[model samples]
Target: MASHNGVNRLFGGTGGVVDGHVHLWDTAAMRISWFRDDLGLPPRVGPGDLARAVATSPVPVRAAVAVQAADTEGESRWLLRQSAAHVPLPGPVVLQYDARPTEPDAWAGMAQAVIDDGATAPGVAGVRLAVPGGAADLSDVAGLDALCEGLAATGRVLETLVRPEQLAAVAALAARHPTLDVVVCHLGLGTGEPDASWRDALAAVAARRRAHAKLSGLFTTSRDDAGRVAAAARAAVDLLGPERLLFGSDWPMSARVAPYAEIVGRTAAALPPLDDGAAAAVWSGTAERLYGAATRTSPAPRG
Candidate 1:
């Protein structure tokens, strides 16, 4: 479809815009992870296309976080490599990998491999897991819980992909590891029954304050229903406040839905306006707090 994203109207605020949710994929490297030909999404859109959108987008987009899809280890690993190789990208724009739970007996041992590789991966800020999706690694409970437990042990935030109703599973897991930070993706997602289960889940996260929510991907999940997404985004901001709200672009996944500019624009509008500090927090500081990404080293005070 032609990119008729509603960016300009929603464009507000002069400070930098940080998109909190997007995904990336390269079809040539491997099959598009989330979309099988059978599931029938638009032709696979990749990073090149997203870069184009970011460059030409009407909104004042300064930075964005690109996440990983459930499938395609190549895409996930490639994103990590790109994060390390690119000199100017200035991120903690990360690759959140999918992880499987281990067999009951072997889980304790296997956790180290996944956690070690992810933590040591060149640009892996953290591992990303979405329930009911991703590889065989995450497709089952025994497997997913195992991975969650391990990531929790390592203190990597649990990047959870959840629909509102299904979020209880993550909540249960979060309950187990009070210390683990859970960054919930897509506002608990949405489908035929999008509702307060998201509110409830956010409450669950808030209670522990061991969680964060990426205020992104509304365009993909809601798919042009800008009003509803805007409303949901506001509620999330109201509940989580600017401090706990992080941005993501949900990129390659957003292709068939809308551009990053529109996603960011709509999400920005939905939330209450921020003062300078809160604005800084949502734009980047908050992510810095959550991800441990290094800030710029100032030039030495030289002669």
Candidate 2:
């Protein structure tokens, strides 16, 4: 059982922490290509599990933004339903939909349709697309310009799951659409060992005022190097500042490597020291502002 006392002490006892990124899925309900039976994770992971994990963790997660795990509209709808069911594990649970189109020409229409559909559901804060190619490849993607325009016009975020090599493209994309809120997941897929190229590319992304990064998924690259992870985090803070960075646990997927508590604790430890204001921004404030989560409040903890 987790208590909010730690959060209270950390943030002057007024607000709770927000997990900027998390994933929940049911292997039986949908097809998650990367999730396997041998991965040591249960077939199903839901908000209840997140609640329990948060309870045990040193940081009390008041709200969460559920990112898309499976590339399907059904999974997005399922996440919204789950979020609606679990009002406040201390706060609100919102979600991002996968709006990637199978055909490049269909992107604009697909994005428009998602925005139209999401208007009725407040939980749909943004959309995510996996960018596997380089900067030139992204620019060549048909209807990408319109997709970014539409998302920017609608004030919906555009979260990209990009590879380390493609980070410069993401930065350019953000520059092209200044109004669109762009978030880079998993610290640009950086590892403990510093790469000058990765740092330079990340710095470019940070230069964009509307661009942000998630301090999550360090284990994926530097599983055994906590010091390396901390160093990377410090560099990110120096590059993006606390206001532009958000804390994400990347749970369930990260559960494949470490427990929820360790994930959150390690991320916390890796960060550069900050005053209360900066710490709150990284932990929750920035997420609340970026995702419009401030209005969503919880009466009490439930697990």
Candidate 3:
């Protein structure tokens, strides 16, 4: 974690930050079904927009992980291209592909394809899937087993956007595939009060050595309640510890509630008091370890 003028450099930033969950999309060029005009996000958002948003933060965002906004191979390719073009704005982009093949053989093929494709795309770090339902639903998800095996084989991460109840299932999934690195996005999307169920589910996730949670998207659920956000952050730290937690802005979408800097400030303020080592782990170290060396070198430019 080297520093320049007190600010840490990209990737290994002890004092600086690593935003593990930022989104980039261009509605005109990409088919993001959720990016409606009424959503309040700009029609097109790129690395430059994110760069400007975090430019004034108290702790500069040295690197970021761009998660998928659309569920298309084309979107994944587009993100790879964007990551290449943007240099280090987003060090790596998470990809999303079809993971719904019901047949075991078909599922295996799809999983193999993801690994094969990812082999060529140096800018890609992992894959994100929306697991909308709870543990039962996860059990019924087609091809998930194959996908987990493939990701583990390649050392790529499996990041899930799951609800509070689904967190226990995610923990089970991680426990099932011990070698696979699992990241639970948005602190299991819990809000209001950190109820017993939510805390238990998070504890289940923490029980898995390779699983982690992101302290992000609090504004989405907590809305303007900064106290709620702080409570959620504290609960995550209490349950998972800073070394197993990561910070993410969930930006552009978060812009609906507040500017990027404001969201960053609020979230930062909400975090529990920590020693520098623990703070660095939550801010950047955990993310770097989970995402691996996706940004160790500049990606090859795509034509």
| Superposition error at 178 for model 3 (Å) | 0.8
TM-score of 1: 0.73
- Candidate 1 ranges with C-alpha deviation above 4 Å: 1-15, 37-48, 58-63, 72-74, 88-90, 93-122, 133-140, 143-146, 153-155, 191-194, 220-224, 294-303
What is the C-alpha lDDT profile of model 1 across 43-145, one tens digit per residue? 5444455567776555555555556554445555566555455433434444444333333433322223322353434244456665644232233544455
In terms of lDDT, which candidate is stronger, 2 or 3?
3
Best by TM-score: 3
lDDT of 2 at 246: 91
TM-score for each candidate, following the candidate numbering = 0.73, 0.84, 0.86
Ranking by lDDT: 3, 2, 1
lDDT of 1: 0.56
* Cα lDDT, model 3, residue 55: 91
What are the per-residue Cα lDDT tens digits for candidate 2 across 1-303?
Answer: 123343334443326678888888898998887787777788888888889888767756788888767666666667777876887632233334333456443343333343345332456666676655545347545556666775566566778777777788889889999988898888786443557877898899999999999988777534467777877888889999998999888887788777887777667667766778888888888888888732222121111
Shift in Å, residue 46, candidate 1: 5.5
Model 3 scores what on Cα lDDT? 0.74
- What TM value does model 2 have? 0.84
Which of the two, 1 or 2, has more lDDT? 2
